[model samples]
Target: MNPTDKNAITESVSCPAVFIAAPASGQGKTTITAALARLLRNQGKVVRVFKTGPDYLDPQVLAQASGQPVDQLDLWMAGETYCRRRLFEAARSADVILVEGAMGIFDGEPSSADLAARFGLPMLIVMDVKGMAQTAAALVSGIANFRDDVSVVGLLANACASARHRELIELALPKDVPLLAALPRDSSLALPERHLGLVQASEVQEDLELRFEAGAKALASEALAEALMRLPPVVFEAPFEDPFVELPSMAGITVGVARDPAFSFVYQANLDLLQQMGAELCYFSPIADSCLPECDALWLPGGYPELYASSLAGNRSMKAALLGFFAADKPILAECGGLLYCLETLTDYNDQTHEMLGLLPGEGAMRGRRGCQGMQTADLPEGPVRAHAHHRSISQGTPEPITHGRRQRHPAPGEPIYRARRLTASYLHLFFPNNPTAVARLFSPEPQLQTCDQSDSRSLSDAVE
Candidate 1:
């Protein structure tokens, strides 16, 4: 059945909820949210972890913290109905639903506070009280008063040094507000970092679990657990409708998707939507997998392909298989990290360059290429394209003359601001369901300036790779 039909089968549900927010971005929302989910999961609760914005990395950490794939809840990106559906789905099996907010509570349009107010989830404000004492109360009070809709559950004194520090901050809070938890300024719990926020959980891979365990134990206590229990639930009706932007399904063939630790940043919803639209989905790992599955088209989603440069480079069979697909001229779609792997060479952090599929001209360069974030909408010479950017590697291609991207920054809320080509490669991971029509066209039989060879699957024993 198609996604629309399958979605109709989802039974709506809602349960106890808590929104981890802060006085501001540096107040440790991501850290606290991860720690809380980890602790709650340790308590045998099925924790449904979520983020309140279009963040890819934080959700990865949160998913690890709860031992489940995390989902996003953004009014701007996914809209209210879709967010409601995700919430409903989580409530079905999740014993507790924890949402990590972006930046300050009231920051960003369709802010976390807006989502919280819409869902009725109580907010626990975490403030980095390192810089002030009594003024902390004023800050929390300002957040509380800034919007009457957002409920102030309690304050957690982050970066506290000692009991005296916690006491002073606790006393400073309005007498009505309580100090839920106090985290001593322990440097040991600090997560790794680089140009972009915390090292994307995937970049850390095997070691992330150990770090998550330590952070959870360090942040959680009896008090935090009690405070979580007191958090008000976001009351809502049943059978919550899905909030899909609705893309029309085009007549198309099966499309294989590459998914593994090396290429797993694809939104789960995209896969679901693709299958719903009648295209078959075949998944294979380029790290060790030799043969591509039965597919008409192929999609390589973004991930830390640079980290596994050597392994992907050595995957001779995978390389050969991809080369076969190129021979077939199959419609191929790839994003950021995936885009990197498609190039002739990918440079690692140590400045070592390794050979990759040379179908695309550009090479991934480790040379410091900062200032690459924000949204972009492509007015592709082929058609309209909407995408985002978040990468560090600059292109070192011989003919890297703007194949198809208009650099966009500080794009207004809900604005289509960037465009690219049929073969778009950007750091900004996108959800196809947001634009079903374009998504449908991407995989449909409709021919534009380019077309894929219509062919049947080849045998795996002697597959392309």
Candidate 2:
């Protein structure tokens, strides 16, 4: 596996491959994915990254690991045609493509297993072997047998205590399947964590190569490469033929987007979609830069802006930009983290209140314990908005006066999640297709974007700074 060999068929050809995953959620998928990308890069192989579900943070980390922007792979969330085209387009340029899984192998609607199967990408199964030995073999055997579309290429056992532990697991799998690598129990390899999942890659810029290099050295054993050689190659799907989304004429309109490490929760697709709609996206650091992007609309998506509340308070320029931007009465859309940033002040984990954009009339602070409440939805006076609560901090800012929506298909009460004056801010992010009118009406300058209609003239907000 000489990484530098340019003519290596599998190495040179942009063949698509996936990390088919999960024995469960708490497995070391994220850590291993990052390590693999770094290791492969060390081998001089070009790598591109993709995550299985509707994840925002991990893709950021993976983008850093792969040295290329990461994209999501869920068919429904990203649109099936979009995912197919992105996968192949990335593969055409990359030497090897790594798509990480979510939850256990078969968790979530359109599970990681389904994504791998749908794209015909080979799978690598990651099993956390913390408490078991020979039983680890039976664990993977059952998972491999559970799904027919998935092919377990190799098993990387995480948290194995010692070489003896690794040997014990290997001996158990000789007749069953190939055991690729065994990762030692090293807490240093684990990243920090809070109410949300693992702290994002942007939060920490330390020398990660130390841990990833060691993990790659340990995992890159002859047995692992041998296992990989045995797995049959995957046939890639052809490039999709969806008409390229037309780029809207940007004549001279600037779209202000909330940025900075504190407010970097926007999706690239949303930005791309806006660009196609004829607006130039401008970025302003909500944590550092004092001025907002001299653009029309402001998009504040979800992120952990509260985690760095003290610094956000110290930075006066961002606050001034936000206040001024809102004073101009341009259209504004805020999601979870952005919603918190739009508040009058954001109290950090330490209970100290820091001033924010002040677009909305409320103050929010951090809370604890009640984390990962699955999904949520809110039925406002306009229509039903869909979302989920994936934060550790709770706040008492503005309250919703309408119906609450649950994650399930059927409707329920008390699920309402967002409300603001001519604005909608919720922890739940809708697909836009679900409620395009509500989204468009929020941007309509008809003096009453607050009023939603089945056929309201959807127009861009006049960029205000």
Candidate 3:
């Protein structure tokens, strides 16, 4: 079924919505949001979950809690119209919409408070009140009063020491604001994290469901339940017309996408847009699969390849298939971790070197520092594309770059872009829906096949073997 079909008949929807925000990062915003989603789901409420930034990991946990795919709601990266459409779509079938905010309440150019104010959704502040008493209330008060348009509905104290600690915070809060819940300090309640952020939900094996249940139990206090019930209903009116641009068709093309532990950082909307543009998508795992599926184009998304470098390095058949795919000059788009896989070698954080596909002229090193991050725009051959870059690894080599990428804030030296034959690789993960036609052209087969030999039947086989 096409994802675009569901949005054809637009209608007004009234769903209670709230943003789970925090004073800063590591203040239990994601934890509380996941817990609330699970608690609401257990209560027979249909919950729609969203992450308020260009985050990939947190949404996985949120999706697990809500039993629905969690979409991103970003003001700049995804645009306002896309966010409104997603909110309306979720509200159509959900009783509540829970959005997990990123970093702090007012950190980035378009913060969580910005989104809340735009949608008129109330904000529930999650403050880590550990090692502080009445000061926590001051922080919440400042966030609430800083923005006249945004409303702070309630406050939740995280990592509190004792009943006295919770009482102190509650007493310090303004009379108009209420203390919704107080979560005691518990190490087990915290999710595992690495340099990037929380470990992906897919990597967490065994007792996953039990972990989410424990998280819900940690936050599902009597006060929280009551506070959730007291939230005002939200009425969302449909726009005068559809907000999405009509996508052109690519009916005769197939795009094979890599999906596994090493390469799973794809945006759902990007995939949906590709499908809407009339491309058939096939998913294959590089870690387990022996060969790639036959297709006109291939996309390798970014993920935690360093964590599973050994397994990926050992996949000889898959490596050969990728090399052959590049040799055949079929269009392939790789980003970040995917770019690492295309390199000659990858050195993990442990300083262990592993062989890679060697399709691109570069070697990647997992330096202990973030290589680059933030929103960027690349001047591609087709056009300018908006993308995000977040990785801790650096590629060392000089390949002929197809374009230069400039970050939105710091337009320093442009980012490196490597293009070998029909392959385009970089650390930037392009949000395909932003320019569907350009993305479609990047994956289109007609341009690549114009130079191919018609007698090479093996290039069109179902699998390498």
Best by lDDT: 3
Predicted structure with the largest TM-score when compared to the true one: 3
Candidate 2 lDDT over 326-399, as tens digits, reads 66777677777877776778887877788776766677777776654444444445444344456665556566
lDDT (C-alpha) at residue 359 in model 2 = 64
Query: What TM-score against the true fold does each predicted structure earn?
Result: 0.81, 0.82, 0.92
Count of clashing residue pairs in every prediction: 17, 15, 0
- Sequence-dependent TM-score of model 1: 0.81
Query: In candidate 1, what are the lDDT values of residues 247-357, reduced to their tens digit?
Result: 345445787788876687767667766776667777899998988887767788877787789999999999999888766656677777777887889998888999988
- lDDT of each model, Cα atoms only? 0.69, 0.65, 0.80
Could you tell which candidate, 2 or 3, scores higher by TM-score?
3
Stretches of candidate 1 off by over 4 Å are 1-14, 199-210, 218-220, 238-252, 378-386, 396-424, 445-465
Candidate 1, residue 312: CA error in Å?
A: 3.1
